[model samples]
Target chain A: MANDLVVAPMLVVLASIVAMLALRPRPRAQRVASVAGSLAYAVAVGAVAWLIVLSPDAPGAATYQLGGWAAPFGITFVVDALSAFMLTIAAVVGLAAVVFSVVFVDRANQGVFYHLLFHCLLLGVTGAFLTGDLFNLFVWFEVMLMASYVLVAFYGGPQHTAAGFRYLVLNVVGSVLLLLAVGGLYATTGTLNMADMSRRLADPAAYGIDPAPVVGLGALAFATFSLKAGLVPFQFWVPGAYRSAPLPVAATLAGVTKKVGMYAIVRVYFTVFAGATVGISVPGAAGASPLAFLAPALLVMGSASILVGGLGAIACDTLDEMLAYSSIGQVGFIAVPVAIAAAAPPGSLRRLGLVAALVYALHHALAKSLLFFATAAIRSATGTHRLSDLGGLASRAPVLAGCFFVGSLSLVGIPPLTGFFGKFLVFEAAARQFTASSGLAGGAVIAVVLVGAVLTILYTTRAWTRSFWGRRTPAVEGATVRRSQVAVLVGLAALIVCLGIGFDPVFEFATAAAEAALDREGYVELVGPAGGDGA
Target chain B: MKTTARIVVPIILVLAISLLLQGHNLPGGGFIAGVLTTVAFALIYVAQGLDYLDSGVLGQEVESGAGVFEHRSVTAFRQTFMVGLAVAVASGFAALLFDEPFLTQTFVIVEHLPLYHELEFASALAFDVGVYMVVVGVLLTILSVVGAE
Candidate 1:
């Protein structure tokens, strides 16, 4: 029973996909099963969280080897504090997005394998989070991307196809790079399992490994990850893809899948590569670890993303486009602290930076998904997501508008909202880094955060006022929002508030996740890969 | 083309089956064998017309003015995909029934069996078969849909 719990989330989603397909002839039953399955997935994630990390007497981390094979020979599935935290974020947003999808997507479209693809996305995310093997991570990434590619082009219109095609082409290139990097790492480190690689990388002399090629390969892999996360220079696909997908699916794309990139960064770089004592030499960076080399690159990408995404959002004409661009900026907010953690001296400050990133990721997931669901609600009622066509929505549908209000305020980092805490921790991390370093780079990072915050407020307020506060436009007059969609928004809005109000436990959870991200020896011990003898 | 397909498809089918059967300890597995089988069908479709499988092979009337979704072969392929998924997942769950971990496999060997004198059945074969079905279903669906377009 204990061993079974480890793979419960993956199994539940697989069963859900199969069950939905089995009932494809009956749309009503299939929809019901989709919802029920999403709920079950959330429950399974919660159970894994409790048993593996949160509960007393919890082991803090556990690994399950598939097919009764021993690690690092077998594919290992790990449930640790970091993955559990990320999974919790995915479950919350995924459930809301799936529920919202049933109501927002047309009945005809829902019958066209919508539920199945959604579960496939969840399964991919779950597998990516839980897999302790490098090659398995790439496989899961492909699974996630495949589902998303179809979902982005779900409408099959010219514009949708165009956006989806661009997305597909870019990601195919990214996947090729990732595959090359993985193969290169395997050759260099002599292992594909993450734990085994980490063990070997920590002591290259014993394993007859050379860690030099890893720097270039790691950069190759990071480019793919950054593309997935929608960081700058690789974020060209963000707005179009988000605008083309079904609004609810866009929410999942923004709130969950983007974070998979962030989670991978933390897991692979910090947990797997941080222990490698490689002398990294970049132009302006100098350190004895790969994290040092990544710090400058991540910081630059993150800061640019903040500026570009914010400016793009400010100029967007539609609500969904604005949110899409905002997602890029929000991910930057998540990435900056991770960069800080990477550059820190691997102590309290490093842990603090990771905690801040995790907290911000959770906040972004809830708040962004809430806002996307609200946008869907507006479109469902008014048949337009154009800011110009929407007005006096707050007076027309007070509840829906209030939910939107909460989401926007959270985005703006107003007090007693989840976004406030997220923003606060991010600034806190950046500020501490600035004080510690007291250098030009540190000061510039803080400045970027400050400007980014102000830009966030500007765009979010523009959206709120333009859509929700002005005189009643033709689209807004007599528009009746769906109660079910509004209910989902309200639930997420309330969750954002609740998480902020009762932030202590969540903070502790994030701290534990951060610790888990940095605890390389503990991870190596948990998986316990045998030596070359394969005993 | 039709004559060539008629001659080559059977050989390809035989080779595919042999590969799948010997996949447990050898180079060929469900994925490769399934792709080979799909290639055979593709040859048949290319040599003959798309409707040949319905009108010529299955002896069913090919309905005019019907979309690919309404085609009988396409529906069968979809069902195959779903059933293949269920079978794969169920095979993994089968280990749980034996109090082992998910996807754990075991084998049974029978001595002095009939004319062969020995027989071996590995549980992993079930999973490989499931994969074979899935690959066939997915590829044929894509082929038919895209080919029709």
Candidate 2:
């Protein structure tokens, strides 16, 4: 059972996917596998949740070594609170998307469609969570990208294909940059273990070494990560891909893909480059330390994303597209705390950012997935996805309308729900001010994020008004809330409430992870320093 | 493109680059190899049909698909990811021989053999193998998609 705890999730996804391989595909097997794979993955998520709940206070993280070799070498699978939290998020979101994919697949022969790409996607998610080294993380990320490329283009319409191309192309460019960063680090530092790299960065003081090289490396890595995370300037890829992808895929893309980027950012920057920003020079941003230079830059970018993403969502027609832009803004919210943390050694602003990020991530993940799934249900019933054509949906399909309202309200940051708390955390964090300069700037950015939340409410209410609040209209056959569909959405709604109501426990978990993340000692402490090598 | 040459371009590029990246202890290493592989995979579609030329030269059907091939037409590509993983694992194992950590390429006889150390070549080869598989897999994946269309 103990070993099964770790191995079961992978097996469930693999087995479900592989089983679909033999099932004659076309309409029957493909949908079955898509839904089944998702259900099984949900169960697998439960397995991990059990692990976290059962061992809440354990001192060390759970680990499994692939092929049984030790570190400084072998690929290690580490499952701490941090990894587990991210895993749960990915699994839940992924499962929801796969479930939606069952119905979204085009009518063409989809031979083993769910089997191959879905399995790869799940494996990549699993791999990303489990890997303890930098190279394996990059590899797993590509695995995710490869699967996503095929899946995004699965519909094969010209528009879908074009979106897929754009998504794939930008991500590829980012991957190249990421690859360069990782390889550069490995080449210079001589180690692939992330924990090892952090140790090297922190130990420069002990060796009395100049901090310039590592600082530069940290900057390059962070910039690549920012591109991945879509932190301003590099955020052009999000709207198209999110708007164009099939619904389930869009949900996961919004939730899982964005988080993957942020997760890498946190893993590398906080764990590896934590305070290297203490002394660097960049124009405009006053830095308490050189490393602090990135703070002003991140703040500017984060604030811009918050404003741009919020306003951008208002112009889009489809609910999913609107949410896509909102996602960009949410990313700004997530970055707020980290940027402040970078400017100051440690402060409440960073802590608040951590909470806001956690809640926002959890909030957006569940809410966006439900929204996307609800869109599919609505379209199938009404044969359209535009909000203009969506009035009177509540009267036609009351349950779905209710679900959609809940999702939208949460997204809008309605008080007492998860979104509000996430925003509250960000606001609190921003107000705390790390460095005097950072404090002033962060306070201003917090105000920007605050306004962005109001925009979020306005847009979401607009959607609710358009879709469910007007006169009753004829409903399409597949649009009514089917028991199966509602079951999943309801499950998500439950999770949404649970996270909001139970913020303290989850917040502690995220904060602890954030705190440990900021501790660079774990980076190299995990990998013992090599003698004059990959250090 | 025909299946035969679909397998060769990557094999060749990987071998050449494997030789080039062997100098990383001083400049470029695994990083360059990964880049070369990424490009090789992207370029694979144009060159895969060259397998026909290989078939003519060998007077064989040119079967390779990582699966058994009845038509012997390079079998839609046999890029051998297993070979790459094997090489990576093998290099990892060799590190054990020097009492070093896994993947930790111990530079034995570092002062002496300048032109080519077997392990350095071996390490670079391991990485190239990953490149080779990546190219073949991507090519095959695209081919499968195009063929289906």
Candidate 3:
């Protein structure tokens, strides 16, 4: 049953790849196959989520041994609440993207294996989420990156090529750093299995290893993940990459790919190195955990990202460019909760932070995909994504305008939308931390997040009003909007609204995922030996 | 180039087959074997040209065959690649039907064989063969598609 949880998605991926390869020369067949494949993948992911939810065990994590080999030696796939949740989100977004691409992508681009690469990208992401070992996570990351490299450069234009090249180079550098960190960790812990590594790291001194180097390696791993997630000081490539990518591909990358990075950070920080301590030594003081020292830095960076991204979005002229910048800010919002989650002890506060992060991630995936899909339709209808060249789209394509308006409102965290609940949760968590800690850092995080939220509204409103309102421009006069594309946007918008209205169940789901994520002992027990060896 | 191809292609093919066959027990495996086979074909293409591959040394009838190989190397490789992927996935699914985890391998031993006393057959070998075909097909597809341009 556990093996089926992992293999189901993989089988969909493999079957999709085969279908694409077989039907490559036939565009119509390829489109149908890709859509069907994506739908099947979504169903498989849904089943996996259902299985995880129905598990009798507390925390709900199931570990599947590949080829019947046990963990700490052979590959294993772990489907916990968090992983299942992420998988479901990814599959849903992937399905929407693929379906949109059937008519959204031009014929020439479709011929160049678009469907094949899309499925490969999903495979990589799902594999990353489910993998139980660090090395396999890296492998999955590479698979994801490889597909993205081509997708970013799908148009074969000069700007697209340059943007793709920068994306490639930066990601490759991040990969190398990750590999170095993984090597150092394996050397110190003598294991690549995450649970085994966690157990070993819990008492490094017993293994004759120094804790400082291990802590440093963990920081390196965090830095690499931050780079992948497009955090501040490492986000130079994102705007270009997002701006130049084919619109649907950009939607998938922003909606799904960057969250994989965030997932890795959560997995590594909370699970693999959950026990490391990292504060200054005081003769009579209790030792502080590494996450305590790391949290402030992450908070500062997260705050900086919000400021930079929000300001950049306000300053950008093009619609896609603004959305790209908005992505950075939204990611920063997600990061705020991540920092709090990492810093807080295993309690309600920490769980709140984790839940906030998960909710924010879910909101961002849907809202951003919706926004980008709307951009695709707008671009198709207007023949440009430039804001100045487009106006009065509401009159020409009222459905698209309405979808974009709803998406923008959700993105800005307006009331009664999914994004508002996400932002509200983060604020509540930050306030809780501030009250408990009464520290300057916690207060600052709360302040910065508040400001970031305000700025989000300002920028999203500006982009919305500038593009969709006022007198019609020449560019919008004779543009044709495809019904299928509009349907995708409306569907996502409807989901956003539905989830917003039914926030209690969704929030509870996210809380459960957070609980599973923070259950270090439960994870170790499931993936490692019980009351033996390292235990 | 022709002299080099004449001397190297046959040896490469033989080496690839040996590697593929022994992969189940030895360090040599389907991936390397497939790569080696692709290298041989690439060498032939570089030395003897696409025309040679289509209708020359391998013969027109061989190229025009209904199964597997085709006159157009790209199309043939594409088909081969898809088939290989399907086969690989199907092999994994085979275990699921038997109430086992995916990609599970089971061995069957035959006793009192004609030439040898016994032989062991493993489903993993079939999976490996699928992988081998995929590797060769992908590499050739890239080579032929890029080479044609």
Candidate 4:
């Protein structure tokens, strides 16, 4: 079954390369082939997700050993519930972005290997989700980043090039830090396999390793992921990159790629360092877990991200820039639950926190993608994305306006929407943890998250009122939205509603995945014993 | 310059082929061989130019030589790239047919050849061939595009 999981990414990579080569001169055929290829990739990923859901009683994850070699020595791919959930969302978003690009992307841009790079980007994103080891995760991140750099600079304007360069430089630094961390980890545990490393870290004395270096390395790893996730202080690149990129590319980056960073944070912190202790023992105090220290740090950063992103969005002039800042804010919301999950011991509270994070990520992926797609339509119709230049779109392009409205409401966490449930779960989880643990810090974190939620409404409402209902400008009155573009937006809007209204099954699935992620014993057992020194 | 390139190119081509053939037994492999082949073509382009390389050594006068080849060379590199990619993917998937994980290699020894000694072949050789084609095709495509620019 795990072997089947590899087929999804491999198919996309192969089909896209073939399509690019075979139909480069024929733009029409290339478009059709790219859409078909992506849809097929989505189906393959869906099948893998189905396989995971079918056998709930199955122990551990489904592991596939590449080249018939076993764990630690060879590359392994695993499809646990969490990976399957992430893969499913990535595929759905990838398919939607590709479909939207067919008409939204200008012909000039499409001709220059856009489809090829898009699929390659999908390949990287999905590979990151499925890989069972840290080294392969880095490889997938590189594959994803290289394709993104090209796509970001696809338009070849000065602003695009400059933004792409900043994105490149920042990520290269992140990559270096990641490599150094991975090196330190391998040197300490003598295994690159994530599960094996986790087991080794659990009992470092037997391996003749000091726990301090491992804990320090874990912090280094966290810093690297923070840069990738665009957490506060490292989020300056988001607005610039999002503002300059082509609409479809920006949508893909916001909707799918950024989540890969969040996924890494969850995977590394929860699975690798879950049982390992950090910090020093004092003469009179009980030994504090590293997570106790790390969790508060994450909460502080998450709060700062929310404040900066929300305030920045309110100050932005253009619709794209506002949404870019909004992404930073939403990422902070997702990080809040991660902090709670990490801080709490393994139990229902931790599970709740993890589930909240997953739910938030899913909602954000859908809503954010819809918003960016709406931006594409607005930019194409009005010849600009500046909010002040646009108005009265509700009467002219009702479907487009409606799409934006629905996406906005969802993003703001208005009642009976997907985002509302996502935020509710995180808030509920935080409150529950606070009461159960009797920690005053948890109460403060809850207050910060609530304030962040309110700020979300403020920024989103501001953008909504100005862009959709402020007044009818000349440019807005004359602009015409295409039917195909409207259809794409409508389709995404429909999914948001379905997720909101039919929240039970999705929530249940997220819970199961959270449990799978938390079950360290199951993961280690599935990966099996590492050979030789790795054991 | 043309005389020297003409004299050296064939020897380089032979060396590349030898590298490819001996790859399974030694350090020289598909990637190095493909790079060497590209270097040989690059020397031709540097000495005689794009038109000369595209038309082959015989020039446009030969009916089968210049016109047909020149038109195709522009698109041929692209085709080569895709074909190589497909081949590599196919070889990896071939293991799936036998209930094995992806990219698994299977070896066979053939002893019945009339003119040659017994040879050991692995499915990985096909994958290496695919890699060889991809490297050559991609390098050539890059060279052509850059040269045109």
Candidate 5:
């Protein structure tokens, strides 16, 4: 009976998503429906999220048996504090995205792009949060990624179509690896339900299974997710997709797609693996051997991502392209806390790490979305996206400049802004690194992350100072900015500020969420403690 | 050309859906099926005028989000079916089901004589059928669209 509330929002989003196929209307009417449906779903999801967080559920184990199914058997929908925290942010961000999409979609293109795909995207993302099954998560990924493919190439011009092709290839490769990992997990565990896997894997000593299979699966899973996270070698598609996508699509990709990977990291590492922070012996571990190699590797890779992504951003000349590079860097920033958590054991850092990751994700989603929209407006008025052709726009568009400034400030982690706290927490966690040899390693990684932050400031400042602050140039290709467009940027900027001021509340919420994740049983209980998170 | 796009759009979509639903049990699951459908949609829009396709659409895009694709799909569904290859696979279970006991097999009979070769049931055949659909539908759709281009 209690499950009704938790599953309602998810069902609502899914219903709306499916309903997209049936709603036939005139071309203009279809456009309106697409936009309106996205907004409605976003709002409805948000309302449900708010209610869930306010409910006085106990800290022990909160669960929801969706569709009257029992856990560890039937599919489940969970809403622990951690999931709730993620859901709330995703919902709000989703709403903002729809608002941007209303005006951004090309009229010549698919009318149902907003109507069906947007709802589908919401369904994928919201489903990602609520489901309790590992395979179910993959299902959500498919929904999210498939829709992304269309939106990324919505304009279907030569440039975007080309970019979409690259994106498609990379995504397929990742999905393959993910499938392999799923296969391996099932082979060893004999069950795909996450809770059962978590419980069974927790005491591998008693399960009597070889450790090589799990490690192998984890490695493959890492490869798949790392690609999605745009880590080191797997990052080729990140720039192209984000760069070529229409402004709103870029915003969603930078803000949404990457988060799915990060979310998976937490889902697998902490909940399923319970902060293994080390390797399993069944793969055959000796005394004080390479058990902890996984954690260190994550740290190193995360550090590398920050460096590469920062350099990439600094080198880009187009505003949108630069944002794409910056997204790579931001993803690294989010991954840092997880890497640190892996390298370090349970301590003060874990809680702060969770907070840092969540806060950074939330702030970046808002800031990045705002920045991308601003870039769109800039392109509309300027007729070009190249940085070299753009300068001295303060006179023509101060509001955009202002939006860019606020978003930049928060994103670059300025004081009292929403972005500042996440970095602050991550840094605090990094500062407390343990292990004699890893002390220096952890220390170096932290230094690299900080430098990445500075690079973020440098590039974004360059963008702002040039695009918005410079003197107005004579008539260029793009001219006459729209107030309707400017309104979108302003609205997002306001959100960044409001969230910034309310950081304390946000921090508290994230901490509780972190506690839930660190303790896997709590999350397992939410969706049914036994069932999966899929349809 | 207009008639071609209109007729092909729904056909491709139907083909794509068929490919997708059968994919888990046979060969052509989400991606290929989705792609086939979308390719068809894309083609129709291209063959017919956007206006022609637009006029026939019964409602606004998908009822929920009022999305751009369904609207465009209405017009371009034939041509656009080239791209809607993505399937809403629940998380990652299409493959996971195979990981269960007995290797997710079904009994099937094939090419038999009078005694016992006439027919049989097989689960692996179901899975293979799924794989076949995904590959054929998706590959055919992509090739056709790219060929048209």
Candidate 6:
């Protein structure tokens, strides 16, 4: 019974998708089932988290082998603290986005495979988070991208179609690269199961494996992940895709799917590849592990993403596009700490770096999704998200504006809010790295974070002042906000506030997740890949 | 083209069914078989027309001027896709009911039962059939819709 809980989230979502599809002709019933399924998903995720990682007698990690096949032969799903924490974030944002979608999207449009695709997206996310095979990860990524490709072009207008096409092309290319990398890895490492690969890579001599090809293969894989995470140089698709997609779907893209990329980075690099003892000669990165190769590259990309995303956000005219750009920068915030953690030796500083990254990711997921939901609320009320066409929403719709205000303040990292701790922990990681390392690299990271924080404040405030304040335009004045949409926004806003106020447990959860992420031995032991030399 | 398609389509479908049935142990499987079946359909559509399956084969009156989405075949294809998904997921859940891991499969061999003599019935065949349905449904849907476009 306890073992069954491991796959419960995925099963619940699959059932929801089937139920929704069965009820496709009945829009009302389908909508209700969608919401009910989302609720069930959240509950299933909660059960997984509690039983697998959080309970007093919990093992802190559990693995379920699909088809009764053991690791190295079967697809494995590992529910560890890291995965559980990430799934919790997905559940929060996913439920909010789905509930918001039911109310915000028109009935006619909702009937056109909207709920179906949305659940498919969730299903993909769940599979990606749980699966322990490298090829399975690629499969899940395709599953996720396939659903999103349609949702992005759901409106089927010219701009939407164009954006979706570009998104599809770029991701197809990314998927190809990912497949190449996965194939290359299988050839190089002789296994696709991450746990088995890690074990083999850890003792290459015993396994007769060459660790050199992995360096190039790892970079190839990293590029695809960076593309998925919407990091710099690969961030071009972010704004157009987010702007074109339905607002709630955009929220899922920004809040949940982006984190899937980040989660993959942490899981593959930190847990799997971190065990590979390889010599790397990257200048700033000094270690004998693949992470050493990752550190410098990640640092440069993370910093650039921060600057590029922030600058882009500040110049955006529409609220959706601005939030889209903001997410790129927020992902940078997540990536920077991961870079720092990759650079740092395994110790307290490393753990702190991971904790900072995880917390920032959680905060960004909540804040950005809340803000997107607020944008959806305003759009539902006023029929526009362009900043120039809107004004005095504060006066027109106080609750909606208030929800947006909370979201914006959280984005700006104001005191007693979730973003404050996210930013503070990130800064603390950089600052501590500065003192401990006594190197130019540490100083550079701190400088980048400081600039990024200021840029965050700048764009968030620009978005707030331009759209929510001043005299009411006709659109704003005539706006009639949907109560349910606003209610969803309010609920998310309340969760953000409550999480921020009661930050202790959240911090503890993040710390455990970080530890789990860095626990290579535990991951391998949990999965226990069979048919190996028992070394 | 019509003569060739008429001759090849049935053979291709038979081969596809063989591939699907032998999927549990042999080289061929649901995905390839599904693709082959779709290819057979594609040849027929190309030789005859999009409405051939409905107007000629199924002996139904074609509603002229109706969009491809309103076409009965397209709807059937979509339903096939949905059913396929449900079947695949249900097959996985069936394992849980039997106190096995999700997607766990088992088989039983019945000896001297009929003309087939020893017949091997594998649980994996159900999963393969689901995959076969999904692939055929999705490909045909895309084919017909995009073909119309």
Backbone clash pairs for candidate 6 read: none
Candidate 5 per-residue C-alpha lDDT over A425-499 given as tens digits, one digit per residue, 9 for 90 to 100: 777777766342355666686689789988988898888777666655553323687888889888888878887
- List candidate 3 stretches off by more than 4 Å: A54-59, A205-210, A277-288, A530-535, B58-71, B109-118
**Per-residue lDDT tens digits of candidate 4, residues A75-167?**
888888899888878988889999999999988779888998998898899889988899989899999999999888888899999999999
- What is the lDDT of every predicted structure here? 0.93, 0.66, 0.85, 0.83, 0.68, 0.92
Better of 1 and 2 by DockQ: 1
**Candidate 4 — which residues are off by over 4 angstroms?**
A1-6, A54-60, A278-293, A436-440, A533-535, B1-15, B22-25, B45-52, B55-74, B112-116
**lDDT at A278, model 3:** 46
* Cα lDDT tens digits for candidate 3, B5-99: 99999999999998887788888788999999999998998898866775774455443234433456557777777888888888888988898
Task: For model 2 chain A, give the 10-residue run with minimal summed lDDT.
Answer: A526-535
Q: Over the stretch A394-423, how does candidate 6's per-residue lDDT look in tens digits?
A: 988899989999999999899788999999
Could you tell me the interface RMSD of model 6? 0.6
Error of 2 at A225 (Å): 2.2
Interface Cα root-mean-square deviation for all models = 0.7, 8.8, 1.1, 1.6, 10.7, 0.6
**Backbone clash total, candidate 3:** 0
lDDT of 3 by residue, A37-58 (tens): 9999999988777766644553
Candidate 3 vs candidate 6: the lDDT winner is 6
The alpha-carbon lDDT assigned to residue A71 of candidate 5 equals 66
Chain B vs. true chain B: TM-score for each candidate?
0.97, 0.46, 0.84, 0.84, 0.39, 0.97
Query: Once superposed on the true structure, which residue ranges of model 6 sit more than 4 Å away at CA?
Result: none
Best by the DockQ measure: 6
> Each prediction's Cα RMSD?
1.2, 7.4, 3.3, 3.4, 9.3, 1.3
Better of 1 and 6 by TM-score: 1
Q: Candidate 5, after superposition: displacement of residue A366 in Å? A: 1.0
What ranking of all candidate models by DockQ puts the best one first?
Answer: 6, 1, 3, 4, 2, 5
* Per-residue C-alpha lDDT of model 1 across residues B31-79, encoded as one tens digit per residue: 9999999999999999998998888888888887888788888888989
